[model samples]
Target: MSELKTKPTLMEPKTFIDGLSDEKKRNDADALLTIMSDITQQKPTMWGDSLIGFGQYKYQYASGRKGEWFRVGFSPRKQNITLYIMNGFSQYQHLLERLGKHKTGKSCLYINKLSDIDVDVLKQMIALSFQARFDSEI
Candidate 1:
């Protein structure tokens, strides 16, 4: 089997955030780091070159694809701040409705800036995603 390319690294999260070229994106990333850290009660870790991951869990697919991944995370992409919501979005319609301006993929929540969203809702979503991973393991 091929190896996972996005494993955790020893790269410092703050250093990575500090190096972002866009000032607004860097500030948004900092806010996200604080919020996710508070919610997960874990220091963020660098996942590969970009993602700032909070906590981790092991996952195995029916097709035998398996790996460890973050419970919740985000990246300051050039176009948007992408949040890794680990659990898919099917269960959080209410929260999403109130999340303000954002987009999503299979497990990503994309936002242009922190000021555009209701941060409290974002925190709840992150906390829910973080807890769900542990809850499933029990």
Candidate 2:
């Protein structure tokens, strides 16, 4: 089987966040690190050079492809911040309605900035996604 390209690295999550060239992105990434950490109660890890991941889940497909992935994660990107909400957004319509300006693609939640959204709702979404992924894995 082919290997997954992105895996955890030894770099500290905060250190990676701090190295971001954009001051605003750095601050937002830091806030996100805290939010995800609080929700998952797990230390963050670098998945590849960009994705800041928390917790983990293992999966094995019917074809016998087995792998592990982050329960939840995010990356500060040039266009916007991209959050990996493993459980997808359809089940969180209520939170999305109150999430301010954002976009979604399957399990991804994209926001232009933290100031554009209701943080409390985002926290709920992250917490729910983390728990849901955990439950689904079992």
Candidate 3:
């Protein structure tokens, strides 16, 4: 198995956000940081280079892969905000219904802009996602 990488070492928000070339992406990252921190009740940390993460949990896959990762997190990618919800969409269909325009993958929700979605609903989704992670004991 590959050695698990530690979380990103960069801690300064300004430098981290400035590292993003797009102004809109930087702003989106800030907004997501606020939302995630509020819901997770944990300070934001720059995960890898681009993902702004809050709170963390360790997961051990049945395949014998194990690592530490944020319980809930988001990455302001070039095209959209990639929301990481480890539980996936099967359990959050109702919340997704209220989330406005978005797409889902195995563990990511993709949205082009925060303005295109409901802020309150997004917060609720984050809270619910975090709860689901805990409830599932993952």
Candidate 2 vs candidate 3, lDDT winner: 2
CA deviation > 4 Å runs, candidate 2: 134-138
Candidate 1: which pairs clash? Answer: none
Clashing residue pairs, candidate 3?
none
Q: For candidate 2, which ten residues in a row score worst on lDDT? A: 129-138
Ranking by TM-score: 1, 2, 3
In model 1, the runs with Cα more than 4 Å from the true position are: 134-138
Regions of candidate 3 where Cα sits further than 4 Å from its true position: 134-138
Q: What ordering of candidates by lDDT runs from best to worst?
A: 1, 2, 3
- TM-scores of the models, in the given order? 0.94, 0.94, 0.86
Clashes of 3: 0
